[model samples]
Target: DQQVKQNSPSLSVQEGRISILNCDYTNSMFDYFLWYKKYPAEGPTFLISISSIKDKNEDGRFTVFLNKSAKHLSLHIVPSQPGDSAVYFCAASGLGGGSEKLVFGKGTKLTVNP
Candidate 1:
């Protein structure tokens, strides 16, 4: 069973527009949620993150929203640019026993068309 799920495998958007990627989780123990962007032949880099204590976190053109009760989270990109096109991953982690590991979703490929 996947603890984190990204139902949409892909998304396409026009340049200078907005892109929204959704994610769901089955684990209630998840206290931290993060979004990572990966380009082909490269590692996923940290994008934005939100703690369970906060419902939203934003940085630059990226924003992350978390809904604890629904076990859901979403990432929003404003003014999407071609450079923003990449595989977006949703990850969750919880602190326990002085250790924590992240559980990530498969990923959603975003295409930004010029």
Candidate 2:
């Protein structure tokens, strides 16, 4: 029941355009939300994150917005670049446990066309 869901398996956008990815979760105990970007054959790298207490978090080109009431979250990349083409994973973890085991979605592959 710890499934975090990313409905879209892929997204494509032109360079310098905005890219949006959506995610949902069913577990109410989850208190941390994270997004990770991954290149082929490489480990996923942390992007942006928001705690359950907050509604929005941003990091340069990346932003994450969480709506706990609906159990939904989204990631936005503004002015996407060719370098941003990669798989993005949305993850969540419960607080109070030092265990950093993150439950991840299948991932959405974003291709930024130049």
Q: Pick the candidate with the highest lDDT.
A: 1
Per-prediction TM-score: 0.95, 0.94
Per-prediction tally of clashes: 0, 0
In the range 18-114, model 2's lDDT, one tens digit per residue, is 9999999999989998999999999999898888989999889998999999999999999899999999999999873325878999999999999
Highest TM-score, which number?
1
In model 2, what is the error at residue 52, expressed in angstroms? 0.6
TM-score of candidate 2 on Cα atoms, chains taken together: 0.94
Predictions in order: lDDT: 0.93, 0.92
**What digit string (tens of lDDT, one per residue) describes model 1 on residues 9-102?**
9999999999999999999988888999999999999898888899999999998999999999999999899999999999999773213789
Clashing pairs in 2: none
* lDDT for position 92 in model 1: 91
